[model samples]
Target: MTGAESWAREQGDAYISLVSRRAGEFYRALANEDAATFFKKPL
Candidate 1:
């Protein structure tokens, strides 16, 4: 894999953690029932 892709894969867990946190922020702004859209989309 390319260097960036390898790095991302190595840090994939961290990336997902951050994305979940962001989704939580969005959920707080909107509502829990509708937050799936944010979480399901690829970052």
Candidate 2:
């Protein structure tokens, strides 16, 4: 995770990840906050 964050920093980009609902707790524990909620729909 640190490596990924560092790479993002080097590129001057924000570190973003898509995590499953079940893993939300784990990511939150790592100091990551929920940036947005995504929803899906049948087309």
Q: Write the per-residue lDDT of candidate 2 for residues 1-43, one digit (tens) a residue.
A: 8888888899998666775779888888989999888898999
TM-score of model 2 relative to the true fold?
0.72
Over 1-43, each residue of candidate 1 has an lDDT whose tens digit, in order, gives 2465458788764332223554566744543343233435568
**Worst lDDT window (10 residues) for model 1?**
30-39
Q: Which stretches in model 1 have alpha-carbon errors above 4 Å?
A: 13-43
- Candidate topping TM-score: 2
Model 2 C-alpha RMSD vs. true structure (Å) is 1.7
- Cα-based lDDT for every prediction: 0.46, 0.84
